[model samples]
Target: MEFSHRDDHNNLSLTRFESMLKTNNVLFFDSNEFENIIQHYLENGKIALAKKAIKMGLQQHPSSTNLRLYKTEICILENDLEKAEEILDELYELEPSNEEIYIQKASILSKKDQHQQAINALMIALEFTEDQDDDADLFSLIGMEYLFLEKYADALSYFEKCLEIDMHDYSALYNIIFCFDYLNKNKEAINFLNNYLDENPYCEVAWHQLGLQFTSLKEWKKALAAFDFAIISDDTFVGAYLEKGKVLEKLKCYNEAIEFYEMTLTLDEPTSFALLRIGHCHEKMGNLDLAVDFYYKTVHEDPLLDKGWIAITKFYNRSKNYQKALYYINKAINIDCENVAYWKLYAVINHRLNFLEEAEVGYKKSLDYGNYELETWISRADILTNLGEYEASIINLMQAAEFYPENAEIEYRLAGLNFMVQQNEKGIFHLKNGVLINQEYQFIIKELFPSITELQAVKNIIAVTEKS
Candidate 1:
C-alpha cells in the first residue's frame, strides 16, 4: 500500500470511529470495515480499543472467522496462550482449510520459543494454502522459524523458495543474504545475488545486498559499482546513496562522497548520521571551519547525538582551542554522563587548560565510568603530581602498574613519584625494574624528571642498568 493513500484512509476511518464512539450510537460498519478498525487499533498498540472493536464486531457478525482469529490474536497478545490454543483448535474444526488458523497456531508456538513446532505448523499451512501467491508468505514464515532455531542453511533454502515464487520478495532476498552472512559464506551470497540480479535486473534490494557483500570483502570499487546499480534501479533508494557515500569516503573521494550525502537530504530530511559524515569528510579535507559548521548542524538537528558534540570538541581540541572544546565536551557529558570516552576527553581538556582540580575530578569520573586504559591512570597521576599531591600520584601509579604489569612507562613514573616523596628504596627498586623491562624508557625519566638525574645514586643506577 502506498503510504499517502493508506494514511488518508486510516485518518478517515479513525475519525469516523472516534465520532461513533463519542455519540454512543450503533456503529454501522461492515465485517471488513470492522476488521480494518480493529487492526488499526491493534497496530497502534491501543489494545483496549481493539478489544472493544472486537466485541462489537462479534456482536454484529457472530460467525466471522476473521474476527474469531483476531480474538485469538488478542488472546496471544495478552499472553493467554492456552486460551489462544483453545480458540485455534475450535477455529480449525470450523474451517479445516483456513491457512490463517495454522499461521496463528505457528505464531503461538513461536511466542513460546517452540520454533521447530512453528515450522511444522507453517509446513501444514503450506499444504492447505490454495493461492499460489500465498506460498511465498508461507515459505517466508518457515524461513523465519528456521532462523529462530539458528538453522541458517535450512532458513536460506526456504527463503530461496520464496524468491523463486515471487521475484519481488525483497524480504526473502534479505533473509537469504543474512543467512549467508551469518554462516560466513559471503562468496556464495555474492554468487547467488549476482545470479538473481541477472534475471531480475531491476531488483534494487539485490543490488544493495551485492554491494554489502562486496563491502564485506573490502572490494571498494566493486561495492561502488553495485551501489550505483542499486541507485539506478531505484533512484530514491536512500540506503544505496548512504552506502555509496561511505565507499567514496573510504576511497578518499571526499567531494563525490559529500555530493551523495547531500543528495540524501534532498530525498529525505537531514539526518544526524548524514550530517556527521559530511562534517567528518570536511574535517579530513582540512576544512576546519566547514567541518565545525556541519558538526554544529548535526547537534542542532539531534541534540541527543553524542558523536556530534564529540566531533566538534575534537576539532577544537586539535586546533588547541581548549575553552571551546571544554564547552562542547561538557554538553556531551551532560547528555551521556556515564560515557567513559567523554569523561576522558573532559579530563584531558581540563588538564590542558591547567584546571588541576576539575581535571582530577574528570579523570576520576572517567575511571568510575570503567575506563581501564593505562594512559588514563598515568595522565591522572601526572595531573595529581603537578598539583603537589606526590603521595596521591604514587598511589594512582601503583594501581596503574597493577593494570599493566609489563609497562615500562608506568614503572618509570612510579619510580619518579616515589623519589619525589623521598621513598628512596622504593624509587630505586622501581627504577631497576623499569630499566630491566625497557631501557629505552630511561629517556622518559630524563625528560619528565630532569632534577632526579642530578642525584648521584640515580645516575649510577641508570649507568649500571644500561651496561648490564
Candidate 2:
C-alpha cells in the first residue's frame, strides 16, 4: 500500500510523521517518501534530518539518480570521495546542465585521482554562464575548483581573469596569492600584493600573504615588518600574530615568539600546531620541563594531531624517559596504526625499552606498510642477529646492501656477522671491499681478517680496487 500523509494547510504530514517517529521510535518514510522528506528538510536547514532521510531513501533507491545525488552530498560532507564518486557518475548523466551536479562531480573526480580532468571540466563550466549571484562568482568558483585540484597555474589564470573583470574581487585576489605561493613565484606575488596593499592598506588578508612571502624568502626582518602591518590592519587577525611568532622564531627570537603565540591563544582556543611550536622553542631555549608540559597539553587539547603526539614522544625520548616515550608512541599508533612513521617510532621505543619480540613485530609491520629507511633496516637486522636468527639477519642486511652498496659501515657489519657464523671466505670478501671504500678503517683490517693469514692477497685486492 502507498502511504499518503497530509495535514492541515496542504502541507505533507511530515511534522506529524516525524513527531510520531520520534515519540514511538518508528521508521516512517520508505525510499521515495524519504527522498521527498529530505528535499523539504534541506530547504528548511534541517540538514541532520535531511541526511537521515537521504540515508533511508538510499536503502530502497540505491541506483536512483535523485537519491544518489543526495547520498553523494552526504558523502562529500563526510569527506568520503570514493562513495561520492560512485554515486556521481549516474547523477551527472541525469542532469548534464546542472551546475551543482557538474561541480560536485568534478570535486569527486579531483578527490578520487583525476585532478587534471576535474580541472578541465571546471574550466569548461566557466564557459557556460549562470544567473546565480554568489561571492564565489562563476570565475571565482572555477578558480577555487582549480586550487582544490592543485592546478595552481590554471587557478592563477582563472583568478587573474576574475581580477581583470573586477580588481576588488577579494576572494579571487586572495586565491591568486595562494596560487602564486604554491607555484613558488614569490616575486610576482609580492609585486601584486604590494599594489593591493597600497590601494587597501587595511586588507589583513593581503598583508598576511605579504608577510608569509617575505618569510619564505628568509627575509625575517622584512617578514616581521609585514606581519606588524597585518596586525595593525586588524588587531583581531589571529593568523597575523601566529605568523609573526614563526618569523620571530626563525630570527632566533624565542622569547618574542612565545609572547606572540601566547597572545594568539588569548584570542581563541590554542591551536595544537602553535602549542607544539612553542614547545619546540622552549626546548631550544633549554626549558625542557616547560617544553614537556606544553607538548603534553598540545596532545591533550587535540588528540587527533599527529604532530602533538610526535612532539611529546620525542621529548620523552630526549629526556630518557622510556616509559613516557612508549606511552605516547602507543597512543599515536592507536590513533593511526597504518602510518609507517608511527609504526617505526613504536618499534624504536619498544627496542629502547628492551621489548625485543614486540620491537621485531613492529619493525616488520612498519616495513609491510611501506616504510623504507636505511636506519630501520639496519636496526632490524641488528636485533635479529642479537636474537640468534642469523639467516634472517643476513637476508635483511643483504637486501639493505643492494640499495646502499657503498655504505662501508653496513658492509663491515654484514662481514662481522658472516665471520661469526664461520663463513670466513664471505667475511674476508666483504671486509676487503669495506676497507677499500673507507681506508680510514684500515687499522681494524688485520683484526677482522685474522683467519686470512695471507695479508699479501688482501693488500693486492685493495690496491687493484683503489687503482680502478
lDDT of each: 0.89, 0.77
Candidate 1 TM-score over all chains jointly: 0.77
What RMSD value applies to candidate 2? 7.1
Misplaced by over 4 Å in model 1 are 1-20, 27-33, 43-46, 60-65, 78-86, 89-99, 367-371, 381-468
- Model 1 has a clash total of 0
Model 1, 26-139: lDDT tens per residue? 766778877888887887788999898898889999999999999999999899999999988988898998989999999999999999999888888999988888998899
Each prediction's RMSD over C-alphas, in Å, is 4.8, 7.1
Q: Give per-residue lDDT, candidate 1, residue 351.
A: 90
Q: How would you encode candidate 2's per-residue C-alpha lDDT over 1-468 as one tens digit per residue?
A: 122444332245466547755775655455556666777777777788878777666666776667777778778877888878766766667766656666677677666667667666665555554553432465676677677767799889878878767776778888898889888899999998998778788888888889989988998888899989999988989999999999888888999999999988899888987898899999999999899989988988898888888888888888899898898899898988887877888889899889887898788888889876888887888788769787787888888888788877667666666766878678778877777678665444445435443555556655765676
